[model samples]
Target: MLRHLAVRTRFFDDYLLHAAADGGCHQVVVPAAGLDTRAFRLNWPPNVACYEIDAPEMMAFRERVLAGQAAEPAVARRVPLAADLRGEWTKALLGAGFDPAERSAWLVEGPLIHLEAAESTRLLGEIGDLAAPGSRLALAHGLDPGEAAGPDSEPGSGPGSEPDGDPAGAPRPPGSAPEEDPAAWLTHHGWRATRHDRAAAATSYGRPPGYLTPRLSYLTAERRPPAVAPAVQGRS
Candidate 1:
């Protein structure tokens, strides 16, 4: 399980860097940011702005910890917006100077599983709405051990109890089934997605396949441009 988490962390770290450097996405947004310190640790390009959104308590906790450590962000701009993901957090994000017209990179990790299926769909839809053409996204998707154990299972008894497990012991929400085809879901939302399975990721990272379980995977996607209607020729 520890190895699994290490691989997942490294994967997303690389994804964010590539999105900013190679993909030309200067604006980055991390929903359910929690205690993540990418804004401080990553080497962002010039004029890059990174937004971290989470609940009020989590935001306050992160601020206090960073303050104590005197941590300075590597990015040119780091904005921490305290807003609940299950609510209208987009307003707070825009008010914090997020420009939806510009291409952006989004990281969605460790949040969706805790939300109901409908809530998860709504969250992704909202993200699609904000993402402009050429925007990049990386997300963690799949069933955790707790989910596999069935909905009625206790939280701490499963793999979710580990340090890298479910955040804050939040059980996988009821009626939240894993998306069978995450790539298809992205395509439906006008994004080109590529899914990396656990085995492939482990091999890429030089980790043994036994280290990671097949139940979890990651998806990296880019928002496609809107389709234009064809012009009709007028009868002469």
Candidate 2:
């Protein structure tokens, strides 16, 4: 799931990085950055710096998987930050030399399920506030079949990978309200999003090697100021 979700070109994350590269955004931040090796694999420009933010345990797990491998990153600098996004991640990242004005790109891949609607608002609001005008965000948000519903809607929730000790553990009860309208929420926050359903994405990228799991849905959003859509203005 990790490899299939994070590393595929058809995924918004891949597009996010490509857009950032094209824009010459040197500083990049990845939240809940578990097992992600883009800094080590992608040919980041010499001027760029990459930050990985996640639980300390997740970072340690990645270290174990990458142990004894040539661990040099393609970028000139890489920073590791251990913190919970639901907490004071902004403070932790800033303390670790993250410049809010760095014209950075952010990836919140696989993050919304772990957050509440309010938490999503706070985190993303801060991101939108801090990001330079042209910075980008690539996110994955759970869909409420009721809203973005039509012939394109697909299955969600499964043998739930719920976290045991935390309240986020249990499978979301059957009739609970969705966190928020994924596309509308982001759009109201001045982000223009392009939605991609799971089934379409899997087909576009072909099947994952051995698993056909469709745990992720996508939103490829470019951080913009208010309604100044580059699309309407004929910009890419």
Candidate 3:
């Protein structure tokens, strides 16, 4: 699990940096931001704005830690909004100065697998609605090894049992049905997505593939331009 966490962390770090530096996105949003410190650790581009959203308690804890450490954000602007993802957080985000019209990068890591399918879908839909054309998204999810290996295989362990460790012994949520392909779901929502497995991630990070588990996958997608209606010719 430590290996998986290390690879996943590196993958997202590189992903966000690439999104900011090369993908032409100046706005960064992290939903369920938890105790993440990317705003203080990463070197962002000039004029970039980062918004981190999480539960009120989590936000307070983060602020207290940062304050104790006297940590400063590496970006020009870092806004921390206290809100719940399961609620109307979008309003809070916009109120905190997020610009929906601007191209943005969203990192939805470590939390989706904990949510129910309906909740996850709703969260993704909200993100799609807020994202403008050419926006980028990166997310991670855990897979059911038994499902991946086929029905004949033994029942696999759940995501909460993984080495990464769940917070406060929260019960593991149901696995998303295999038919609900994340890439296809994104495509339907007007985003072009690419899925990556553990092997790919380990290879990219110069790590051995021995730690590769069928338990996790990553996705990176770009929001496509909205479809335009065809114009009708008037009778001459």
Candidate achieving the largest TM-score = 3
Residue 235 Cα positional deviation in candidate 2, in Å, after optimal superposition: 38
Total backbone clashes of model 3? 0
Q: TM-score for candidate 2, please give it.
A: 0.70
- Candidate 2 residue-wise lDDT, 168-208, digit = tens: 32323323322455544555566655555564466556556
lDDT of 1 by residue, 77-173 (tens): 9999999988999999999999999999999988887887777788888898999999998888775343367544332221111222133433333
Better of 1 and 2 by lDDT: 1
Better of 2 and 3 by lDDT: 3
Q: For model 2, how many clashes? A: 0
How close is every model to the real structure, measured as TM-score?
Answer: 0.83, 0.70, 0.84
What tens-digit string does per-residue lDDT give for candidate 3 at 1-236? Answer: 78887888888888898998998888999999998989989878888899999999999999999999999999889999999999999999999888999999999987777787788888998999999999999888555322477534432332212322124322223243322556556766778766666555686667665556545567788999999999999999
Superposed Cα deviation of residue 4, candidate 3 (Å): 0.6
Instruction: List where candidate 1 sits over 4 angstroms from the true fold.
Output: 143-180
- What is the RMSD, in Å, between candidate 2 and the native fold over all Cα? 10.0
